[model samples]
Target: MTKKLFYNDAYQTSFDTQVVKNDKDEEGRDYVVLEETAFYPTGGGQPFDEGTLNEIRVDNVEEVDGEVRHYVAEPLDASTVNGVVDWARRFDHMQQHSGQHILSAIMQDEFGMATLSFHLGAEIVSIDLDATDLTEETLEKAEERVNEVIRDNRPIETKWMTVDESNQYPLRKKLAVDEAVRLVVIPDVDYNGCGGTHPRSTGEVQMIKLLGWSRQKKIVRLEFVCGNRVLEQLGNKHKVLNGIKGLMKRPEEALEQEVSSFIKESKQKDKQLAEQMAQLLEYEARDLASTAGEAAGVPVIERVYENRTIKTLQDLGKKIVEQTPSGIVVLVSEQKDQLQYVLAQGANCSGNMKEAAEKVMPLIEAKGGGKPNFVQGGGTKAIAADAFAERLREAALETVE
Candidate 1:
């Protein structure tokens, strides 16, 4: 087994090690196994450490086949190289990982809530609690309690223990590994088995901020940010609010109320516009009926348009037929590489609209069927809507005669 340098010192930023083996992964990517490494591999819900090996970018690190392989952007030619960990990223992980320990411990102790799972995400950290009845009041209390422990600046101790020795402390959760049990203990606060890295003390975690929570099946997943992440989240939210504030012309404190008012007003205006459009469509239907052509024994009205919805065509066709008894209406609209249409007839008409629709469908590869007096459907623009409309007019005159 390769010696683990990060196991002992989470704060170790740089180390010198020799490449034990240079190998290629299954994908033909070059990787190296070091004699010893300070780079923490991806494990225990924490991401892998990113930095450089001899100035060559170490894209990923993982324990594969009992050896910690550093997957490099390019193969490392040097036998001996200096490995440096990105401290900003490493420290941020520590803050979130350590803060998770505190937050989970307090939830279990105070709320009888067991953490079902934990995930340290790139932007936010989350823990799924077994509790179904979690509330904002409980979160407020839990946040305060967790921050209290952070303020205490309790020492975070990590040590290897035998299965029997681990029984001495009350662990928050069971150890996954039985042989080499490693426990992260927060003095008298929390004792749990975890392999992920952490800060030196609770104080180094800065603070725990519970952003929000939602019920996921039976568990409650709580989202939050810790340490500098809390600051980053705040700054992002401020930028969004500032931009909206300028657009709304409202003070920061009054922005929420003003936004709510603006949405209400916009909805009202949309309703009024819909009403006016409906009245205009009614008048347009009358104009179309006045210019109808006589086919067989009924007045036939047909029009093709671009970019009109099938629903609008159906409504207009129905209105024209209703207003002019014994009249036939055929409306088609070209809609981006396709065409839609509606065929309708008023009462006292023997025109077989369904037959008329069938006669023109094959030309456009369309499938439509309706009663003896009405039909509606659409298909790809294999043929122009205007040409298809003429075919329908001829078919209708034949069906009626």
Candidate 2:
């Protein structure tokens, strides 16, 4: 196994280690394995460390079998090289991982809640706890306890022990492995077996902020941020609040009430507009019914509109047929590059409107279905609107014959 330097000193930013293996994988990606490395591989819910190995950027790090491979863009020329860890990223992970430990421990100690799983994301960290519901009071209490522990500046220590030696400390959770257990301990507070890197003291986590929690079945997943991330989140929220205030031309205190009032007024205007539109459509339908031509002793109305919606054509067809009980209404609308059509017959009409729709639909390769009295469909505008309407009238007359 490669010597894990990060486990010894999480603060180590640079180290000198000889390249044990330099090779290119099947995909032609260059990778090097160092005899000892301060770079932490991606595992235990914490992401891998990124930096330069012999000045070549290390894009990814993974442990396969027993070796830690540093995937790089270019292969190193020298066998002996310096490895530098990206301190900013490494420290950020340290803060998040350590903060999770304290928060998880306090949650269990105070509420008997067990952390089922943990995830360290780019902007946030979350822990899945085994609880049905997490109330606001419970969350605030746990957060208060966690911050108090951080303020105490409690020392965090790591101990490597055999499977038998691990039983001595009061572990918060059971160890997954039977041998070679490494315990991270905050004395008299928390003890858990973890492979992820963490800070030397609880204070290094800076501050742990529980952003929110969501329910997942019987568990509650708590989202949080630590250290520099907390300040970043606050800055972003403040920026958004200021933008909203400017847009509304109101102070932050009055923005909520102003937005609520605006929404109510807008909804009222929309309702009034809908009522006026219904009245206009009713008048238009009567005009079409009166002007319909005779088709085999039955009234027929055929017309094509521009830029109208399929729903509008449907509504007009329904209204015209209802007004003229012995009539057939065939309305088409050209919207964008397609032609939409609707066919409807009055309650007293003897013709099958479905047959008329079937005949005209195939002219434009359309698809639709309806009862014998009403049908609707749309397809490519292969024929002109006037020509299409003429064909539809002929089809309806044929149904009458």
Candidate 3:
């Protein structure tokens, strides 16, 4: 087993070590096992420490069999090398891990909830609780309690004890390992077995901010952040709020009212605009019907549009029939990739528009349905829009007879 120096000094950033063996993973990736290492391997729901070995970037660390292998950017040529851990990343992990321990302890103690699993993400940390349901009041209370413990600045100590000696203190969970059992103790607050690195005291955690929680599978996954992450999130949110305030031309205090008023005004304007467009479409329908061409001794209105919607076509067709009580309406819309057409007629017209559409449907490979005087459909452009209009004109005239 490689000697893990992090267990002795969690704050150690640099260390002198000798490469015991240069090994490779099953995928032929280069890794080196040092006689003693300060890099923390990936385990205990905590990520591995990233740093440099002999100034070669250490990408990952993991325990294989009994050796802690450090996967490197390039295989080390020197037997005697210096390892430097990235302090910012290591400290951030420390703060988050310690915060998780404190939060989990409080949830188990005060709320009677057990943390089933924990995951430290790139921007946030999440813990899956045993219970599927979590309410706002319960979440708020838990958040308050954890921050209280963080503010207390209590000492966080660890003990290396045998199985018999571990039985003396109250442990939160059962021991996973029988030999070399390491227990992390928060004085009288919590005593749990953990191999992950952490800060010396709860105060170093700074603060823990709970984001939210939701039911995931059969458990509740609660998300949160700690220490510098809290500051990062606050800075991002402040920037977004400032941008919104500037766009709205409102101060911070009045921003909410300004946004609400803007939304109400926008909705009213939208309603007015819709009403105006409807009136304009009605007028257009009447004008088109009045100037329609005659076919089979009856009026036939034919118009082709580019990129118009089926709903608009239907509305215009309805209005045209309402205005001209004895005219047939044939509307074709050419979209970017497909062709759409509507066949409709006035009440007094004897034209079977459905029959006309049925003849056109097979030509365009289209699907449609309607009554004897109304039918609408669209499909891929099997034929050009102009040719389709001519075919529809001939079909409409035949149906008029």
Q: Best candidate per TM-score, number?
A: 1
Consecutive 10-residue window with the lowest summed lDDT within model 1 = 173-182
Summarize candidate 2's per-residue lDDT along 1-401 as a digit string, tens digits. 78999999999989998889998877898899989999999998899999998889999999988889999988787889898999999999999999999999988989999999999999989999999888999989988899999989999999899867988878887788987998999988899998889899989998988999999988999999999999999999999989989899998899889989999999999999988988898999999988988867889899989988888888888899999998888888887778888888899988888988898898899888788899888998999987888888788778874
Candidate 1, 1-401: lDDT as tens digits: 77888889999989998889999989999999999999999988899999999999989999987999999999789899899999999999999999998998889988999898899999999999998867779989999999999999999999898978998999887776769788899997899888889888999999989999998998899998899999999899889988998898888889889999999999999999988988888999999988888866679898999999877887788788877888888888998888888888888777788988888888888877778788998898998779988888888777874
Clashes of 3: 0
Q: Tell me the number of clashing residue pairs for each predicted model.
A: 0, 0, 0
Per-residue lDDT over 76-157 for candidate 3, one digit per residue giving the tens place of the 0 to 100 score: 8888889999999999999999999988888888888899999998799999998878888988999999999999999999
lDDT of 3 at 80: 87
Which ranges of candidate 1 are over 4 A from the true structure? Answer: 285-302, 309-401
**RMSD to true structure for each model, in Å:** 4.1, 4.3, 6.0
Per-residue lDDT of 327 in model 2: 89
The weakest ten consecutive residues by lDDT in model 3 span 392-401
